[model samples]
Target: MGNHVETLRWNGSAIEMIDQRILPHRIEYIACDSAQSVAKAIRDMVVRGAPAIGVAAAYGVALEAILRKNEASNVFSTSLEEGFKALAASRPTAVNLFWALDRMRKLWETHQAKNQPELADIFLGTAHEILEEDIRINRAMGEYGASLLPDGSRVLTHCNAGALATAGHGTALGVFRSAVEAGKRISVFADETRPFLQGARLTAWEMVQENIPVTLITDNMSGHLMSRGEIDAVVVGTDRVAANGDVANKIGTYMVAVLAKRHNIPFYVACPLSTIDLSLATGEEIPIEERPVDEIKGFRDCHWAPEGVSIRNPAFDVTPAELVTALITEKGIVDNTTLTAGELADFVKKNQ
Candidate 1:
């Protein structure tokens, strides 16, 4: 299946990214001239989705190198370190950000003998390659995941895991796209994904663009819909997956997983190998991002909460390994029921 959207592109000079904050209403692109600008864009939600953020961070590193090409070795090294730190700090939950940055850092370190200008070319080229590779990875994962869905399946998803979330294609939504392409007439139920509405804003927009059958519902309505036997399966994208198969995704993902478990519906998590953090033994060790309380209190200047109300907004929640039916990756699916931490370690090693 072809990607219906291009979330990020390089123009030989700067990184151009879709501004996700105004999606489904206004389509806008933002150009990042410096590493700081790219970092700000990620933190500001101008660019998001784990894979997209990773690609953006890689470009941010490249932009830093391009801007600091004239600096002396010591000065360039300092600036490069700062650039990595800034981009990595933009979002803490996505392991892809750290993975991409680490790749760039290692590549830069390997060519330390070269001049700064020479290293600049290497950095930008590698970043471009990373973006391309991500698109390919998403497609491969899509194919593997698509097989899991039968004809006329109604998949429930949280947040926006379509093209807007990755370099192209998507993780969870990619499976749906591939399944549709394989002649399986499937529909999607997207949760509004509270405080951000990534599902309502981005997911719905992407599906409508491709003429995919989709239904928009509030986050709280997922269980009701599932109980009515309206949902056949749950497929979601994750920020990080632990060695034990635990998943950390959008805030309300855990609740959806629990509901799926109760209804005996299969809950699947779609992600690339880059999203797997084998270093973390379990989800308890995964860092969850705490967003501002104001986000829950209002919706882009529209406030509904009463005065003096206290709100807590966590960007993600960990779904225990036991809750996941299986994990869909580029390598294939790993059934959580029989999968073990040691087996996952081996899978990561062989895939890597």
Candidate 2:
């Protein structure tokens, strides 16, 4: 997912992809040669992210159509609908997953009059467009987010929002990348986001490759760092933004924002325009996804205590807009006015 959400390898009849389970450690591409296999992959998080899911769905349906003996039937349609239902059921936090999939469905139905091969080409083209546009949006976000900080600033970031998360550049990390390139000598304090270790696995990997100075610390250590005046700002990525400017991000983000607010350090929420959802009234309306207890039960699935200790893990949390300094988007960094989150979003849309 460095430069694209999903990578598809078409062997004239099948679609193959890299299994995200062992990413940034072991690179493995599994053959998603069938609709069921790909759908299961999506459900199991073998492949993920909004744009990636959409592209995967497109290819999944395409492969089904191409491999069928009878190409002029509605069987592909029925299978495609089932695949969409399965994929959409995998995760609820990232609304973009369903959004992109629905868009793909529409594109598929709209192009039904075209030849089979032509429709396949259309899906591929749509996937590629989403890929390229995401990269461009990341670059834009970097440019706009950089303007919010001064040179030689030390910043803190939570979770993973680097190239691995986006199609290319990234959202929150893109801001830091731009600052570094501008000679900001920025140091990133990474909070090893608990439960998933997205910070440790994805963020640390990105910082290492970019040669950015990064310090990894436990989730509880963030407030300590803030108290010592070691942090200048906190930037993080969001899965969804409510109409009230409340942001739902990887769990533990609300804590970081509260700390930032108390410390008087600027806290920023970086995201693409797609992450903002005007349908929801507030963060409370955002559905929180709860995972298995195994995450908090062990570091690497190994029990630390010799007992039946249960664990509670919520995938994401909501951060109120008041704690944020500015919202960085592809268009520019916009500060919310006294208006409500929904009204602010309308303002943003008009400006864009």
Q: What is the C-alpha RMSD of each candidate to the true structure, in Å?
A: 1.1, 2.9
Colliding residue pairs in candidate 1: none
For model 2, the stretches where C-alpha displacement exceeds 4 angstroms are: 1-20, 48-72, 305-307, 337-341
Write one digit per residue (lDDT tens) for candidate 1, span 127-196: 9999999989999999999999999999999998888999988999899989988999999999999989
lDDT of 2: 0.74
Model 1 segments more than 4 A misplaced: 1-3
Where's the lowest-lDDT run of ten residues in candidate 2?
1-10
**Residue 303, model 1: Cα distance from true site in angstroms:** 1.6
lDDT of 2 by residue, 240-343 (tens): 88877888888899999999989999988887777787878888999998977766777665767557765678888888888777788888776843546367
**What shift in Å separates residue 159 of candidate 2 from its native position after superposition?**
1.1
Name the lDDT value of residue 333 in candidate 2. Answer: 73
Task: Give the Cα lDDT of each candidate.
Answer: 0.92, 0.74
Q: How many collisions per candidate?
A: 0, 1
Could you tell me which 10 consecutive residues in candidate 1 have the lowest summed lDDT? 1-10
Q: What is the TM-score of each candidate against the true structure?
A: 0.98, 0.89
